[model samples]
Target: MTCSTLWCALASLACLLAAHNAFAALSVDATPPYIKPCRKSDPELNQCIKHSFEHLRPYLIKGIPEIKLQSIEPLRIPKMVMDNGHGAVRVRAQFSNITVIGATNYTILDVKGNVTTYKIELALSIPRIETTGSYEVNGNVLLFPVRSRGDFWAFFSNITGSGKIYGKEVIKNGVRFMKTEKLLVDFKLTKSKFKIKDHLNGHNVIGEAMNQFLNQNSNEIIEEMKPGATAAIGKHFKNFLNGAFLQIPIPVWLKD
Candidate 1:
């Protein structure tokens, strides 16, 4: 072959090889057997979805609720800025929260020196919420280091609560399945609202609403499910429920 023709042939072969490798990689990364996405016209899609959820059935069962209360000793309170210039006072208070079905747990840490701020910590037991399983948590309050003057009282008072269960799935399980790159839980809360009372006047003031947000990289849950580890997945689930309870708001009279 002529020199020019030989050079063109070699370049074409290299391009073909590269394209083949790319296609192979894409095929390898696609969903494996028994877990393929369904097309709209395919009747098998429903069955596939159903079977996928069935494998996660254990997460759906409602186990007995378990509650643990631990008093956190006074920790060094951090300074917080308030509307007034007076230095915030340090109020040492017991901190406790609950966990239910899964292996995870959450706790209220402490209020900031100003008492206007609160801190909370959450620990998950699984890598992600199960797709076949369902979870529902309803109420107003969500998160800690309650930020406003009335947030603390309102959080405690408007604690009306409920939760619903739908389904969830791990969209992307990262390398070697050690982590889920994206975890999604599909559910809704029936009544999620927050009520704050004036720190001094005790007057009621409601706040903005709550809505669903996708939870990603649920490392908390994954960490608990480490190989051969005898962790209580149910307790973790319950912890999720209790965390939901904290997010909800109860009526003032209920607090009394």
Candidate 2:
């Protein structure tokens, strides 16, 4: 296949993972035999969907083979680059081999949907998050020129967030399907801690100082990078969701 054709194929395979709450809801009696779909006419549809997510959590934590979802525990992100700051925290950094823990612990605060318009809104809270990875960074932070390559660790507490899922329905082979068009998500951290082990032999002072500064002003730093961070997260989840929607028909997930 040509490059464009290959891309088209890949996208179709990932299509739309339906918001599954509002944007996505599979029939409890569908072939998948996994999802407990909510009814479009139910008055407590949102809460019922929330229960569906709860029921599906264990499978999602371990992955679902039929739908091709992978384990989310210690969720792996191969790489992330940040260079968007120009203020007191101007820096260019590449993070690699990242693993995060605590996604399975999310508490659904609210879920709202309008399948008619193919929109989904979700809210949740996470008590804590821990992450580790390798990083390379250079440029000015807190107005001081710094360069470092190291293994990094971070902790976040009391995170609260919400997101919106957007999609449009399309007809393929006379079957209705939803194609994810856009996603938006954001979150806030009540407390944060950061550490970077300076790979350069015994340059502990600079690393320690920087870590201290980062921990002390993590709120500011997080704000500086929030846009890129949230965008990357949304992109990752969108693709992951697509994996399920592509495999299952819309009628199987939610019927009119």
Best by lDDT: 2
For 111-226, candidate 2 gives per-residue lDDT tens digits of 88887887878777778778788888888867678888888888777877777778778765566776667877777768777888988637588788778888877788788767
RMSD of 2: 7.7
Off by over 4 Å in 2: 1-29, 200-202
Query: What lDDT does the true structure give each of the candidates?
Result: 0.20, 0.64
Question: Candidate 1, 256: how far from true, in Å?
Answer: 59
lDDT by residue (tens digit), candidate 1, 1-256: 0001011111111111111121122232344222223333444533433333333222223221222212111111122111111122111221112111211111111111111111111111121110111111222122322222322210011111111122222122231111112111211112221222323233333122111111221222122222111112222233333332232211100111
TM-scores for all candidates: the values are 0.19, 0.80
lDDT of 2 at 225: 64
Off by over 4 Å in 1: 1-46, 58-97, 100-179, 184-187, 193-256
Residue 139 displacement in candidate 2 (angstroms): 3.5
